[model samples]
Target: MSMSEAHERRLRRATRILDIPGMIVGKAAAWLIVPMVGALVYEVIARFVFNSPTMWAYDATFMLYGALFMLGAAYTLGLDSHVRADFLFNILSPRWQGIIDGAFTLFLFFPAMYFFTVATFEYAATSWQQGERIPTSPMMPIIYPLKSVMPLTGALLFIQGISELLKSYYSIASNRRFRDEDGHP
Candidate 1:
């Protein structure tokens, strides 16, 4: 194989290795929907049929939904499902696309993710230290756990971001589309 091809293979290998944990975490987070839906159903039944409302339901639903949303980000990135202005992007050749994408990933995407990861970690740490709870809730479910998800999500996204960056670099170097795990373009 040519040097560029070997380099591309290595980058692809690295991306695949990094993708595993993000896939697992994202898929696991998807199961949170079951509990979120259950909480909503319970609240509806309790409020309308039983003439009583639940204190925890509102908070539970939002928290669960938020966690679900945040945690699925890395998975979404892996699938390349995040929104992009693909109308113009679709017209570009693979080389030009890779150039733009690699540049953006390096100069913009990585920095943003790094700052987000750092900030969320500090936020979670402070929340944990303070024994924080949802101040608005009567039951006041301990919020540190929910707060903790932020950093976890950030870390996952960062991991996936590295994979994406590598893919971008490989594409730019090879002048071709980076193949998926199944070897699809």
Candidate 2:
């Protein structure tokens, strides 16, 4: 197969795998968010009507919201939907844009993610070992599942960063200059 075909195939695989986290997060959201919302509303009602507050609602919401946001990062990167400045990019050709994009992924994205993964794992492990629990009236037992999301998202980002690097490197190899948006040579 030609490099173009190979690139397309690889991109397709990457795009699909990159979406796994988002799908999982989206599904998890139904269970997590629904209850959290219900609990918050219930807690508010209890506090006002009965003069009693639910201690766990705030913590539950934090975890649910955190999971939703962190798990979506991989999907965001896959779609190239992460925030960027279009102003300067409007001036460059596509291939050049690809090259610059790859450089950033290589030097910045990969290393940063690697460190984040290590740090997250360490913290999660410690929390799990200690059997961490919320220091509140309810004293809910907090586990490491949500804590593990940090490293998992980092890993997804790392995979996506390499995929982007390969696309950029391929572009640079094909021509010193980038093609237009149409991808014509």
Best by lDDT: 1
Range of the 10 consecutive residues with the lowest summed lDDT in candidate 1: 1-10
Which regions of candidate 1 are displaced past 4 Å? Answer: 1-6, 179-185
Among the numbered candidates, top TM-score falls to: 1
All models, RMSD in angstroms = 2.3, 4.6
Predictions in order: lDDT:
0.85, 0.69
Tens-digit lDDT track of model 1 for 6-41? 766677688889998889999999999999999999
Q: Write the per-residue lDDT of candidate 2 for residues 99-175, one digit (tens) a residue.
A: 78888888888889999989998988888898777666365747577887788777767776765676666556564
TM per model?
A: 0.91, 0.75
